[model samples]
Target: MAWDPAVYSAFAQPRLRPALDLMARIEPADAARVVDLGCGTGNVTRLLKERWAAADVVGVDSSPEMLATARGDGGGVRYLQADAAAWAENGGAVDILFSNAALHWLGDHRTLFPRLLGRVRPGGVLAVQMPHNHYAASHAVMAEAAAAGPWSEVLSPLAARFPVGEPSFYYDLLAGGSSHLDIWETEYLHVLEGDNPVVAWTRGTALRPLMDAVDGAWATGFLAEYARRIQAAYPPRPDGRTLFPFRRLFMVARKG
Candidate 1:
């Protein structure tokens, strides 16, 4: 699926908070090579370069559009276009392998996490953060709208799987591979402005694949129905701002 940098970056401030929070927990020092796996648009990747100024920072992403934006920023970071899972498997060992708001898109975490931890050099770190709000109304309503429309035949398959597992699932997967592991979850209640902000928010991420699968009147009707459902699920507050509770999972593991 193609990515729209403008749409994804529309809520840049809110989307960045979890990455910043994840960065604060990393304890690596004087890292040599740092790879930002699935570093969309390279916003957080630039920060990685700034944090580890001496390290060679490479931003890996599959989207040409996102990579174009990242490359345009020109912060002395190398950008590579590759499938994130392929990169995770074959990308050379690094001092720090960091991913924010990525990885959850791929399945089979049972193998993925351990394999990722192995890619970190001895005493190096693997840090990641991903949206853990699959059960929340924001996503639940998306599934609801998909199954209730003529677009269901096309969109149902896209919404079939939510790849993010619970905190314990990850803890068990990473505990044996790392000398030190820190795993946690945080739910941020984002105060968003404007009409149907939730739909706007998902349009950039979760809603993109479904939207991409169809077009014409079918697309218009599907979006309209989704918007109607989302508006009711996440009504605006008395102050005209919407409180969007987004939960994210974070982990920082230092390989033994």
Candidate 2:
């Protein structure tokens, strides 16, 4: 199953407002070489370039489909198809490593964290934001709905898995590191528009992997059941809207 960058961009911009806000806090003068890891379509990457006009900006992602959608004529900005973890491991040095709404997909951060930290030059910063909604109803519903009927046999084994971690988990990883680290979590109550905004939001991000794991017929059934569960879990407001309380984790570490 291929990633629909268009579908993703439609929802990502609005939902990812917090991420952009966090990225804005960085001082451009402090960064010379900047990299946006998991840069889906280069939305945030563009912001980085605008902030640091003289810096060399690179957008790295593993998806060819996503890279294809990224704009390449930004002069100093270059989009590369590369695994973020692998790139960091190979000592792809930079002054700032910026990431948004992407790290959660690469669940095991124990090794990835140190490797990325090593890639940052002295006094450089690593700013990252990831959704911490694995335990939320939208995701919980998927596991619950999948465990019933015919889907159980296939989904049960994977039910115990979810793609997010607690705030303390990251604090522990950055502990004892020489860099100055600031890690925190927040819940954003997004006022989503449309009749089924919750479904629309998940369809673009969280539900992609599950959709790929099942057959076409089963995928349809899975989404239908998942939608019903989500409707109950996150009911619509009186004004034909839903308040999506999305939780996210962020960490900003500066290498000394």
Best by TM-score: 1
Any runs in candidate 1 off by more than 4 Å, and if so which? none
Report the number of clashing residue pairs per model. Answer: 0, 0
Alpha-carbon TM-score of each model against the true structure: 0.98, 0.93
Off by over 4 Å in 2: 72-75
lDDT of 2 at 111: 82
User: Which residue pairs overlap in candidate 2's backbone?
Assistant: none
**Against the unseen true structure, what C-alpha lDDT does each candidate score?**
0.93, 0.80
Candidate 2 per-residue lDDT over residues 50-162, each given as its tens digit: 88888889999999888877864464589888877778787468998889987777857888887787888888888888888888888788788788658778865565576
Pairs of colliding residues, candidate 1: none
Q: Give the lowest summed-lDDT range of ten residues in model 1.
A: 154-163
Candidate 1, residues 184-205: lDDT per residue as tens digits?
9999999999998999999999
Q: How many angstroms is residue 176 displaced in model 2 relative to the true structure, after the best TM-score fit? A: 2.4
